[model samples]
Target: MALTVSIVQLAISVIAFPIFLLHFLGLWDRTCKKLFPYFMEQVTKSYNREMSAKKQELFSNLQDFAGSSGKVTLMEIGCGTGANFKFYPPGCRITCVDPNPNFEKFLIKSIAENQHLQFERFIVAPGEDMPQIADNSMDVVVCTLVLCSVEQQEKFIKEMYRVLRPGGAFYFMEHVAAEPSSWNFFWQQALKPTWQLMFDGCDLTRETWKALERGSFSKLNLQHLQAPLSWKIIRPHIVGYATK
Candidate 1:
């Protein structure tokens, strides 16, 4: 029996090795990007409904960044699938940025569907380092459901501040880590490794506020609330704006 079990384990490892290597090389992410937008659409259906009210209130604070054009100049980092496009105020000129070029087509389609907002351009760049966007240039910066997956939390948060002009607003909504003593926190830590690997490196236990607090925003108005996500680990969310 022991010999048979050992042989079976070896066979399973041999079969899984190639797939593991492919994932390590990010071929899996490249392949999955084709379907991820569609998948996200399905997944956020109910989630979007629950959060719509809060989003409306958050976006209502849009300021006219375009002096005479009467348009808000906005930049969205990690603008996946243009999920927040509908929430933007009318006549806003939006520059969308994401590390993945695969998102461009999906964003184009999303922009087509939501004609209220103006599409400026889509740049393929990560949030932590976007040199094409000059320092203190953007009027408003938005990020939603993206903080958990960034490569460096502190660097990315600071980057958001750098690109925003003085007196600009940085709007953010993100699922965050649970309270330290809670049962959810235990599970968040336990499942994090596998979750990070499978979910494109989303860390369930990120204390996102720490980095945000360090960002040196002139005025930060952060609020913590439980979102209506079925996944308990991702239910704790923080949403608000920071003025630079």
Candidate 2:
């Protein structure tokens, strides 16, 4: 049994080794883009379930401002597969930005299923550079589980600030770095190189909360929570909002 298990693990590693090598060469973005939807369904679903309450609260904040205007204008960065669409209220005019164009079809399908949201536009761009979105044009800026993978997190936050109208809220839910003494922290450091390569540049040890604070939103409210053990390496999470 041990020998069989070893062989199976070896075979799987061998198959995946070339992919990781290519990913490190900066040539894997396309492949990562294509695999994103599958990763959401297979990996993120369980994490979503474990953090459903926090997710609900993060989205629930929109309730206070929903439909206050003719339509609630929302912009989402790294809007992968539109997983957060169901949380938004009906008649929300949404602008989605993602570096990967492959997510367009998946996002469209999600929008169709949600029925509450209106698909405004899909821009094939990263969060760090969004010159097309006018200043103070958005009512809400939504980002969840995305900061972990962005190339320039600070620039991304600044862009969100620039695009949101005065009093608009930025909602976020992200897995952050574990505590220094924890087992997960050790493993996170140990596996970071491979993990980032395999998971589209996601960092397991990012201090995302600090970045949010640095954005200097007018109002900041945040809370930390321990993620379910199934996701230990990236277990610590911060969920809340910052208003500009």
- Best prediction by TM-score: 2
> lDDT of all predictions, in order shown?
0.82, 0.82
Q: What TM-score would every model get versus the actual structure?
A: 0.87, 0.88
lDDT of 2 by residue, 135-219 (tens): 9999999988899998788999999899998888999988888887776676666666667778888998898998888886999
In candidate 1, how many clashes are counted? 1
Instruction: Tell me model 1's lDDT, rounded to 2 decimals.
Output: 0.82
**Clash pairs detected, candidate 1:** 167-244
Candidate 2 contains a number of clashing pairs equal to: 0
124-157 per-residue lDDT for model 1 (tens digits): 9989998899898788999998999998988887
